[model samples]
Target: IGIFMWVSSTEASWQDFRKPCIAVVDAKTPTTRIIRAVSVVLLPFLVGFLGYNSMKPSTDEPIELRTVHPAPPASTKVHGKTFVLQTASNPYRVDDSGKYSDKVQNDYKDGNPWDEKAPQFLQYVREGGQIFFQNCHFCHGDNLNGRGMFAFAFNPIPANFTDAGTIAQLQETFVFWRVSKGGIGLPREGFPWASVMPPWEQHLTIDEIWKVILFEYWHTGYYPRTWD
Candidate 1:
């Protein structure tokens, strides 16, 4: 009777110990629940900040923004040559001014006349140089030496303006005429050779043409002696 009683008591004790263990397993609680929740909330924002920093544009720390001023007007007094001052917006009309006409007879067959003013001549040179760079630099080159970027592909290469002998031989009127009319066989001439010269009469005024001419003349060392 004593042995039966001891066995029943032992079995009851074991049952009592197992009950708490089973309850614990059923609860299924994580140890770091609070930490995990905080991490999940902040992770997206942290990742986005890092990505934005990587993609940010670089700064130009040392350089400052600058404002450019418009260039002053150019003037010249080459006796037979007329210099007109007009903007690109108000181009001269061929009908209103005899400067540009389709009539071959109106072409500047005579060369430019010599002027005697130094100050006016210098101003013309400065203005002409700027115009040449803006319009003719792509094909005529910055030095007016004719080896422009596109000169190689051209069948008849652009004329070298720096060649003193050549400049001496060429008349000012011829230069103006060529610039006004452009090449004949190339694309400019509406032919197969592909001259790239655009007709400036539509875009540039007669005064602008004169300015360019003055610049070319001064570039070749022909400074004017008078201003009037």
Candidate 2:
């Protein structure tokens, strides 16, 4: 009990000493007092200026989110009656038939009907870039080199689109199909590595998917094969 009282009295004495010491320091002037006083007056303005500049958008940021058109809102309505979203098991499972047995001969669904001659080719590619950054950049990297932020997590890393084996040799149709179907569409050969690619069909329209493909080719400087 006495020890407790002594500690309490000692703490009180220290507090009292600190109050007077603080006052003494405040009373005296240091050599840098003027500079400190000026700084204190200007600190808020300095902070405001820096904050404003920092908030301004960067020109070099890969994608501008504000200007990009967001994906269409999901709707369950089919007719003028009660609305319901069509739910089914993985669609790929039902069509296990040789989907790619005759790749060259097969009439693979081309997402983007518009070709390079189209006036909106550039615009489509630009929009596709925004989409790629939003959806694919995490796993495909900013350069689409497959060394993305999450690339290390996958057993077999994401395909490097820049490689000759990837977008260079493959037809746009194959690329489109693979992207739309994603990991679920992986055949027996693509199995066991644990692909993380998600089906983009639900989120991206066929045209949007094709646009991104166009961006990949243009950015990588690889030309698609001609039917000739």
lDDT of each: 0.51, 0.58
Each model's backbone clash number: 9, 0
TM-score for each candidate, following the candidate numbering = 0.40, 0.46
Candidate 1: Cα lDDT at 150: 84
- Where does model 1 exceed 4 Å of error? 1-118, 185-196, 222-228
lDDT of 1 at 65: 31
Model 2 residue 89 distance off true place after TM-score fit, in angstroms: 28
Across residues 166-228, which tens digit of lDDT does each residue of candidate 1 receive? 544544444454455454312222234334466665556667875786666556554222222
Off by over 4 Å in 2: 1-119, 188-190
Residues forming the 10-long window of minimal summed lDDT in candidate 2: 85-94
Candidate 2, residues 38-123, lDDT tens digits: the string is 56667777898899999988877353222111121122211222221122111111112423222211222233423545224444
